[model samples]
Target: MSMKTRTVKVGPVMMGGGWPVSIQTMWKSPLAAFSGPGDPSLLAAADEIRRLAALGCDVLRFAVPDETGADSLGALAAASPIPLVADIHFDWRLALRCMDYPIAKIRVNPGNIGARWKVAEVVAKAKDKGVSLRIGVNAGSLPEDLRGMEDRAAACVAAAEREVAAFEELGFQDVVVSMKMNEPGEVERANRLFAAKYDYPLHLGVTEAGPLIAGIARNTAALVPLLKDGIGATIRVSLSDSMESEVIAGREIVACAGIKKAGVRIVSCPRCGRDSFDTHAFLARWSGRLYALKDTLEVAIMGCVVNGPGEARHADIGITGAGDFVLIFIKGEIARRAPLEEADKAFAEELDRLLG
Candidate 1:
């Protein structure tokens, strides 16, 4: 099927156009991270976001829960080097306040924010202020009217439709929709249903998806199909981990699905009998060194030479273990062989060279 296309403007960023799904992370800094509500933690968050941007994160979101947090927006926006999305809930005034800032996007569940006019006001403000709006619908936080429904997906889909309809009615086409469920299948089905019904840009995520490893796997399983089907415009790997980890995981997910052209791709065997090295230890070392290459290089870390180089010949750089030493392959040819002890450093140096 030819994917239905929709374009949305978020601050200065334009999403959709079959744009490679952008990676996003919500900043978890407590108010303590700021001196107070309006206190500018711009430097602190910007520092973290700089690392994220270097790691190839396309968008960063911060929770604007109160007046103080809302006030921080302008400073953060002025200082931030990357696009920023403001997450607002509970108060329409907060969203209204966010409109005054230089945020690239605003994410709010239309259900919780009071009245139809309130939503219209928010949408209008975003439209007037040139900031994009994300109508985020979550299963865990479904409207009270939708609670205890016989079918939760139906309830979520209905809620999402209503929200989308609101935006459509407002003549606000610069909108993206998200229906997040904790379960992988639920999110998968919900987005599928939404994609079939609506032409709006979609932001896909499985909310509250647990800690690091589990969360990444669940987000991947849910997002991969929809993404491959040309269903989503942006993606967020919502890990209960650090923002850096979330960006890394999101990039990896898109890369693994063969959708994202940038970012590192490390392919190591799950450690079978043919393996001769400490596969687990090797991956640990490799993952750290990977930070330097970060979002720019794709390296395959394979356990055995048998299927290693051939399976990963497409990779920019890769390594295959041969008895005591690992052969480092750049593109398809063997560049050099390094002993296990120096493999991580060698890989890092080689990756830097490749990126240069």
Candidate 2:
């Protein structure tokens, strides 16, 4: 459970050590078409960013495919409420351009960015601008030198170390490292290997984690253990779902792992034969209202009264289904009962009162 203490500055953000794990989401908009010289795409990105910001994203990343796309940085940085990170694949010039603005961070793998001096130049520019760089290493795009290695974890670690070493050599220590894989087990193993050796901030995520359910499961599998052991600094839930959903899932992961402080965690039991009312629909109906609350709360929605109260004793608020009625419990006390028809509004009103 040894984690490196190396801290990195992502714009004004300081990650690693005791820093809370941040939730980040990527933009789905066209990187190439999102901007222009004077007609900056910042305003366009603003609308999308507002949505993501409302979902509580800690950082937002957009791909800088080319130079024209880089112009969007100013508007995004100017109007964006959260830190902005530029994702650069091979172009060192785009990396430089990203550093030119108040960009918070850059995701670039020195191993693939080409030429030693180019890497140094980018690193130097980032250092000069006081911008943090995330040395992103992915299993899908491992270095050719490590292509034949039977152990992907070793290769992943080597790749990360190579970039970290390069950044360290440039007298720049503001670096966060990630070793991402589609397989949860591989991602965990590689991160485990890295955590054992270095103290640099580790960004945890499962790359290309499929559609919603599978992606959440995979990300949960990889993160739970590391998080419990105090291993991760920032996290991203990469799913083929909406960016807001991904951000929500990321926050949930942190909450479930007990690494983050968020409002209102609703613990609902899986409906079984004994459940009364429609537990599934009841939960689905009230979940959004709970999500809308400004303050964080720990809530439980149980299927039946049999074990509902006992199981929900730890939650700040609880609800148990009984026939066509729902018993709303606050702090383990039965507060009121509402019919199935009025359950949604009733719960929303109660939660609003509870939050207020």
Candidate 3:
């Protein structure tokens, strides 16, 4: 079901036109308070952006509510290695200001961005700057006329259609559309509807998706089917949890859909009564680092011998516990042994050797 779509380049990455579907996450911090190139907050954000990019987030978005947000995000975008998107609502001026920097895209709700001319203003700037736009149509905020429609999914698609028309009318076609709803079914229905009619690349997501467990469940349910259908060009698993969780979950969802399958896959066992190694603690400590690796490898973090060497024999690297010793193995062969206290350091060294 991998279909061709019009490609939109965002800085170093390209979306659609049979390109690999990208993973994205919103920056959780508020940038309005930080201003200028010298601000420490922006520097910290830049460092975090690098870390997120390393963790497989292809694009990063920040909410630009006012001029101050635009000011800070502009400075940060100048230094960011990966492309940055300015999520602007209401004010088209902020989009203009954000475009003053190297921001790659602007996300706007046609309903919120006001008149057709306002959108045109943004679109004109977007075209001039070689920037892209995402027509963000959320279920919570359909048009005034469409609000009374019984079918929420149809209303979302209609809103997106209207926005897409608005952009094309202005002769600006570098567009991506998203029709998000809290319910996974509604989101999927809207995206499927839009994908059937339009060639614009879609930014797939479920909005206001709850915390870690609920968010991943909802986003996965909605995105997987759409990805397999070749309906999405990029995906963001919006969550009430950390941004890292969102990016990691997005990667897993894309892989699960069989759309794209190149990343560090973790095969960790859930500890039980016979558990020895603390799988939970180890995974928490190493998850980010493992995910940041560029190699396509399976790393198994198991609790005991039963779940480790024998069960995860195909894994590129693995660790488990037996009686009084923690064992590190490569492809089912025990390569290093350490006491429980020294497992972390020993596993780190073994992982380096394995990856090398």
Candidate 4:
């Protein structure tokens, strides 16, 4: 059981209050083009957001640097199916401006968002708009006074506490806090301390967590322990990679921690001397579409007949190949066989039939 905190509604999804731990990822492209209400590009962006949502992303955040960014995000928020978050820095006006739209949440560093009154103004606006705020405390951007503190984890906890106090003083309680550090240990330690001190929802993440392989490893190290101990309420696996990859990694982490069992899980074999099938190519062609599935299905793609049916006996669907022929297994039993060149089409037909 996860730590229970106050429930904050983000558009259609609910965070905390024992709700499922949600996944968040940032938007990669420039936001200017998305401001147009019904432009082709804007429509395309909406379509992409829908795809992301289908892949188990509960919240999507975009950086709002200026009024233009606010406009762009506002327009997109009007049509976004999932909740949209505005990441604000320095200027408090942009935070104020972003609330004018249907933006679900605002992420701000109270330490960097200037004097108390400025943060107050932003909080007031957010409260009026039913927009919850995320106190995003990053290790690299601690307040000047606390920068010299030797216990960095404690400093992070203090930073989040200050912000939490600020919000509480103003009678605003819809808050989520994240204390992120590049190091997994610090990330876990800081977040653990904060959760012990407060009941606000915590957003778990290891900031600037490197490339794909290393990032996943570092995040898993920090997050799994907190999650298993019932500490985190929502999570973002920050990566130097695509947003889709980030969302998928976040879901996998949550699942691995036994937080939630949801979405499609893809299992594949690493090719070796005995392998005749191209597992990599097969996954490359099918991974995205498979992850987009709403139903929870275990899918296995193996390099040969040996690892195919036996290892994936419980998989709802399995596919593998050996030389001239390809085989498709349904529940560990061979259901279809096709020539090498025709395998993909044959699998697609069976998949469609299975899904239908």
- Which candidate achieves the best TM-score against the true structure? 4
TM-score of every candidate: 0.86, 0.88, 0.97, 0.97
Please give the lDDT score at residue 259 for candidate 3. 69
**lDDT for each residue of candidate 3 in 1-356, tens digit (9 for 90 to 100):** 23588988888888888888989999997885664677887788889999999999999999998888888888888999899999988888899899898899989987787777888888888899899889999888777888899999999998998888878888988888899999999999988888888888889999999989999999999999999888898999999999899999999999999865577999999999888889899998999889999999888888887767775577888888776778888987889889999989999999888878
Residues 31-150 of candidate 4: C-alpha lDDT, one tens digit per residue = 774535778877888999999999999999999988888998899898899999999989999999999899999999877897999999998998888899999998889888888898
Q: Rank the candidates by lDDT, best first.
A: 4, 3, 2, 1
CA shift at 164, candidate 2, in angstroms?
A: 1.8
Q: lDDT values of the candidates?
A: 0.79, 0.80, 0.88, 0.88
- Compared with the true structure, the alpha-carbon lDDT of candidate 2 equals 0.80
Colliding pairs, model 2: 4-199, 5-199, 263-296, 263-297, 264-296, 264-297
Which tens-of-lDDT digit does each residue in 49-112 have in candidate 1?
7878877678888888788787776567777888888888889888888778777889998767
lDDT of 2 by residue, 146-251 (tens): 7678788788899898877877778888888899988898899999899888888899999999999999999999998888888888888999998877888987
Deviation from native of the Cα of residue 34 in model 3, angstroms: 4.5
Overlapping backbone residue pairs in candidate 4 total 0
Give the 10-residue window scoring lowest on summed lDDT in candidate 2.
Answer: 31-40
Off by over 4 Å in 2: 1-4, 31-44, 309-314
